[model samples]
Target: MSTVEVLASVDIVALRMAPEAQHLQVLLHRREREPHAGQWALPGVIVNGRTPDTSLEAAAERALREKTQVVPCYMEQVGTEGNAFRDPRGWSLSTYYLALLEPGQVVEGEQLAFFDLDSVLARKVLLPFDHNLLVELARERLAAKTVYSSLPLYLLAEKFTVLDALGAVQACLGQAVNNTSLRKRLERLRERGWVRDTGEKNQPRLGRPQQLYQHTPQGGRAFMFERSLLPEGV
Candidate 1:
């Protein structure tokens, strides 16, 4: 009797959050060949070796460089999916990684744009293989993280207003937050000294002048570390 050997593969998915539009965007590359040719799909590479020391992080970095020529600001492992029929060719297990990047960092590819999660979910676009499920999982992870962490900062520019920051958070969660509750959360963040008012007030058309703010270096690191420790499903 001959024994069948299982093959292992690693695939990285980069998720970019845009708060203003309140969307979680995944980078999809257009395929130039058969098996969903001209279709959009996540950037990934196949890993093969006896000792699988190959990290998804490295694969993600390499994919970014090769596809978009950009380095992401944040990366984290989400989970693994292994189904005998997941791949068309053979039995494979794919390890997925999530990444966050600032706007304008990546070179746009054919049909590249940050898409709104709500729109994607509503329209039910056919994703390549099981990639849609992977996206849903990543979206839930990011939305839950943004509430008490500084993950949203990656979506904003160096200097931004409180409203801008709050909008980003709301977008990730796919809903509008109560003004009072949101303000309280911001106050708590301010108390922790994670953010600073930039001292530049912007006068809008029909409202009180709003003060701008920026994330402090100390605050940024603290938020990142705190987020890393958040319990699963947080």
Candidate 2:
């Protein structure tokens, strides 16, 4: 009898978002073949060599280029899955990465589209492997990060309105934000000059004119935080 040795492999999973007023839309691709054929899955690729640089992060960049022809604005490893039986072909370990990109920044290939996170949650879409769990974990992390960190900036345009900025944050939290509290948060940001009013007002339908704003050049650095794992076994 011949014994076949199963080798460990690394893969990358990326979650890209499209900012919307009520929810942060996530990008998902329909797999064309097993192990999750015809199911929704995150964009990913396998690492070819055993090196630290040829890691999950590198795989994610390659996947993005192949799938959408664009590099992610920001990406970080979120966690890893090393279940022995996770892949039907062999033993595989996947390192998941979370990426944030602006809407329409990438030209998606076939079988890819932006999906509303709320709709996915409501419909309970069955995802490939443990991806459904991964999405949930990513959502929780994004919500917490948006509260005090600069993660939300990735979703906004280079210049945006205060309402638009707040809307993006609310979408991440998936809840209504108190007007007073939101104002206070903006005030703190303003005092530091991390954000400033652009002195332009947008006249949208059925509302008084609202002023526009933009994050300062230093806002990106100010809002960034060291990426950390979700939790052990999460």
lDDT for each of the candidates? 0.65, 0.63
**Tens digits of per-residue lDDT for model 2 on 1-234?**
113544343333333446444456667777877777877777666564553445555667777766656566566667776665666676666667667767545554577866677666555666666666666767777777776675665667766766766676777777666666556666666777777878888888888988777766362343643432122332
Worst 10 residues of 2 by lDDT: 225-234
lDDT of 2 at 41: 75
After superposition, candidate 2 runs with Cα above 4 Å error: 1-20, 50-53, 104-106, 217-234
Worst 10 residues of 1 by lDDT: 222-231
Q: Residue 188 in candidate 1 has what lDDT?
A: 62
In candidate 1, which residue ranges exceed 4 Å CA deviation? 1-8, 17-20, 50-54, 104-106, 217-234
Model 1 lDDT at residue 227:
31
